[model samples]
Target: MSADIKAWYLSKTVWGGVLAIIASIANIAGFGISGAEQAELADGITALLAAAGGIVAVAGRLVAHRKLK
Candidate 1:
């Protein structure tokens, strides 16, 4: 694949993974529940943030790529 594609893939994968881990850790630490409730809320918030981050990242990448093109 081209460098641009590779870079995009890397950015999305790496940053997405990082954000997910962070959110998970934050939820685990932020709310000290150890059962279903904890998992539910933490996973919910983390998924939400991860989705938002992915959207922003993709949009930014598209804009930057457009500019480069």
Candidate 2:
């Protein structure tokens, strides 16, 4: 909807950091996720989100009545 819409950075590295924090919390709660498992989970989620974003973009383009300026 805005010019900056295409300018944002999407970082999997940041997601990994966040996931690490979550894993730490989970470990404290006795849920027991190791670093490898956290990384795998984060990768899976990142892929799923990327796929969903592509789908949304395609659907939006298909339904638009006006072309991009």
Clashes of each: 0, 0
**Cα misplacement distance, residue 10 of candidate 2 (Å):** 3.9
Query: lDDT value for candidate 1?
Result: 0.60
Q: Which number leads on lDDT?
A: 2
Off by over 4 Å in 2: 1-9, 67-69
Error of 1 at 17 (Å): 20
> 1-66, model 1: which lDDT tens digit per residue?
574564333454454555566667877888443345544555665666668878998889888845
Candidate 2 at residue 32, lDDT?
86
> What do the candidate models score in CA lDDT, each in turn?
0.60, 0.78
Q: Please tell me which predicted candidate would have the highest TM-score against the true structure.
A: 2
TM-score of each: 0.41, 0.75
TM-score, prediction 2: 0.75
